[model samples]
Target: MIKKPVKIQLSEGLDARPIALLVQEASQYSSSVYIEVDQKQVNAKSIMGMMSLTLLPGEEITVVANGTDEKEAAAGIERFLVNVKNR
Candidate 1:
């Protein structure tokens, strides 16, 4: 298993539903991907779990990945976040 800490800067404050969908899609590529906010952790694969995160703008969320293709997972998510920025 491999673990990587990735930080993402939100382009704007986001609603729970859309953010959850993004995380869910990310996890589909790799189950090891996870999102952590306010000391609470959730599996990126679970939309419900990700919705529960409720992150705010400018928050540096930490993504932790542990499993096969962890590096790929992290890289994928990092690129996704940057590309989706509305700002």
Candidate 2:
């Protein structure tokens, strides 16, 4: 298992479009991926689960991955959350 912390960078926050894009990116990995906010965690691949979290801009979150491709999955999510903005 691998875990990394990241903050949502979008000024507009994680709206519907960004969540969908993040979900799409997460679904590509074979590892089990989850996003954690406060003490709550949800499957990154589940759109409904992600939306339920109501993540906002500048909020700190954790990306966790565990599986054969855990490292890749964690890093990918970190990269997406850290670097990608508004898409």
Candidate 3:
């Protein structure tokens, strides 16, 4: 398992479109990916779960992945969350 803290850099924060894209990004990995904030954790691949997070710009979140591709999954999620261009 790997866990990395990432600060959301998206100017619009995580709305419907971004959350959908994020779910798509997470679905590409074979590992299980989750995002944690304020002691709440949700599957990164689930649009509904991610939407429940109500993530906002500047909010720090932990990307967690556990599986054969755990490292790659965690890094990918972190990159997506931290890069404004990805939003």
Tens-digit lDDT track of model 1 for 1-87: 444454555655556645755765576664478777767877877777776665665666777777777777777776666554642
Q: Which stretch of 10 consecutive residues in model 3 shows the poorest summed lDDT? A: 78-87
TM-score of each: 0.73, 0.92, 0.93
TM-score of 2: 0.92
Error of 1 at 19 (Å): 2.1
- Model 3 score (lDDT): 0.87
Best-first order by TM-score:
3, 2, 1
lDDT of 2 by residue, 1-87 (tens): 888899888777787887888899899999999999999999999999988988778998999899999988888888888776734
* Cα-lDDT of candidate 1: 0.66
Backbone clashes for every candidate come to: 0, 0, 0
